[model samples]
Target: MSSVCVNQALTDDELRWVLTRLDSDKDKEVFGLVCKRWLHLQSTDRKKLAARAGPHMLRRLASRFTQIVELDLSQSISRSFYPGVTDSDLVVIAEGFKCLRVLNLHNCKGITDTGLASIGRCLSLLQFLDVSYCRKLSDKGLSAVAEGCHDLRTLHLAGCRFITDETLKSLAERCRTLEALGLQGCTNITDSGLAELVKGCRKIKTLDINKCSNVGDAGVSVVAEACASSLKTLKLLDCYKVGNESISSLAQFCKNLETLIIGGCRDISDESIILLADSCKDSLKNLRMDWCLNISDSSLSCILNQCKNLEALDVGCCEEVTDIAFQDLGSDNVLGLKVLKVSNCPKITVTGIGKLLEKCISLEYLDVRSLPHVTQVRCSEAGLEFPKSCKVNFSGSLTEPDVLL
Candidate 1:
């Protein structure tokens, strides 16, 4: 007869939504006092209620939380807050989230090896884990992950400078199923460290060692030889120690390679790149030679002439490439080329870009930022009409961002 009793008798969907919308965990707890049925409803409604607020508010709602499929406590927690967060707090959380798959703890600067080890205890189903930018994590912590998690597919540790070659070598032995791994900016990872990873982790399809200054020709050669048949994507950006020989080795071995990024590898000349294009011309889907100062348009032109399967090309800051490079791609009947970045090349003008817009009609994104000739030359003199469908960000004519898409 009472209004409270009348409201309590509503449909399950309405009751669930109502209980979830009630703010404060204390208030959510209050619902249980109403009846056993209401207490049952609170159990299911609390997670949905926690999801309504943002990710950081979940810990407040659920104290005994565990068995999470994906845990992204990355932005909410930092490394400094680690080891001290309590094993009981986590064990209660991890017990329910036994199905935890993806864990992204990026920028958790306070988290030490102890807290990492605690989390690793419950990581049986974890697949993709990114602890990138977590500065405090060392070999001790990574050893825990490598030992605990079995089916890890992707592991990213970019900019985690504390991670040495030892951590990588250890992972190669334990995490055998690792398909995609990123060790970018791990400066201590040398040729020997890379050798262990190359020889031990044979199933790796994508490997990133960008800015790993210590990795030299020997390391690359080791990887090229060991994982030749398996490697499909390789990134060595800012790894200046390796020269033309390593590149050639990669070309010989990684024939099925679909993506190769060697940006900022100054020692690698145009010759090896051309050889790579000649050998694996049809297989390479994405090629990024950005900031490689020695590379000229001749090799690139040769690549464009032959490798018609190019999907994404980044020649940004390669000052040697002139309008000729763009011309080769322009109206050359090249199919499947969608994204192109030719920013900061002084020789390319609006005329070449204009002509190419018509040719690369399929292009969805084009960035030609800071091209002196393009910005300096008068639009009328260039004789190129800007197209509509493509989002072109140029130094001269492009001003607005496309909003419709």
Candidate 2:
């Protein structure tokens, strides 16, 4: 008198077909525990696996799925029970998966140079590796990666403070095909490393050097000179020492530049904006200059007039930007503008914003937070109607800034 006999009597072929129809790994895993017949089918077909388990569990998973190609041991809020996997564990895991191409070890605190070295030696075909927030990894571990994984195209080493010029120099020489590199919070990086990177990694397109305080005009100039033709996106958030020289260099040389962020670079003035508006007008799509206190209405006007293709613009905390800037910003030439953030700019009012919204037919998001006069009630009082395509964000509303520094 056993209950739930829906699948107990089915033939092996019928059971395998039902297991194959399951789209999620979790469901298939639960079914695998139903019986030995289901376990064999589920394990053999699995090619991707995401686990919060320690090395022992990872080894068990590898043994079950012989064809596994992608593995993620990154931290997750939902799976807090998994202990941080260690170096010896990585050595074991690396040997288990010969076809592993992508491995994400974000915030795996126990992993160090030794663990990464093991991965590099075993997984030569690894193309994407993210070790962001792994505090224990240093140059020694990265050097091992550079020596072995020549096919790596995207690498994220954000928050790894011990990485220096030597690590970058080594990567530039070995990972020549690398297109994206994230070094956010690697404050020790300076001109020497960037110079070496520009010389060797000419094909690099996206680079994030946010919070690398030591990177100044000297390093940025080299990037602009060497990778200008290929570099499409550049992030220099919190690089306080960067000034007009680096801005000018980018404007003059970076012909294909699309997204540019210099948030927290207080040294940037109206001149840099005008230069950028003039040089990268045709190519520039997104521009961010948060905390650029020196820029005023003139700079905004210059950008609006020239960068007609801009889809996203952020000038938050630019206190000098007044209502006058919005007059030209609403013109038909900037029809492509979809997202605009003017938060913390004390000078903008209901009149200015209403006018801008009326003309920006394609605008979908508007952030006017912290401006006193541009509230929802005030816009209604002014008899202004926003386009159906646009979502107006007023003071104290739910809107978030398009870019955060």
Report the C-alpha lDDT of model 1 over 1-405, residue by residue, as the tens digit.
645764557977888788768878789889877887777676644432222222234454454333346666554433344432333444544444566677666665656687678666776788888888777789988888888887888999988898888887778888888889898899999999978876568888988888899988999888888888888888888889978988899888888888888888877778998898888887888888888888887887777766778878888888888867657664446456677878888777776677566666577777878887675346547665554566667544665332100
The estimated TM-scores of all candidates read 0.78, 0.88
Single out the weakest 10-residue window by summed lDDT for candidate 1. 47-56
**Cα lDDT tens digits for candidate 2, 196-239:** 98777888899999999999999999999988789888999989
Q: Pick the candidate with the highest lDDT.
A: 2
**lDDT score, residue 171, model 2?**
88
TM-score of 2: 0.88
What is the alpha-carbon lDDT of model 1 when measured against the actual structure? Answer: 0.74
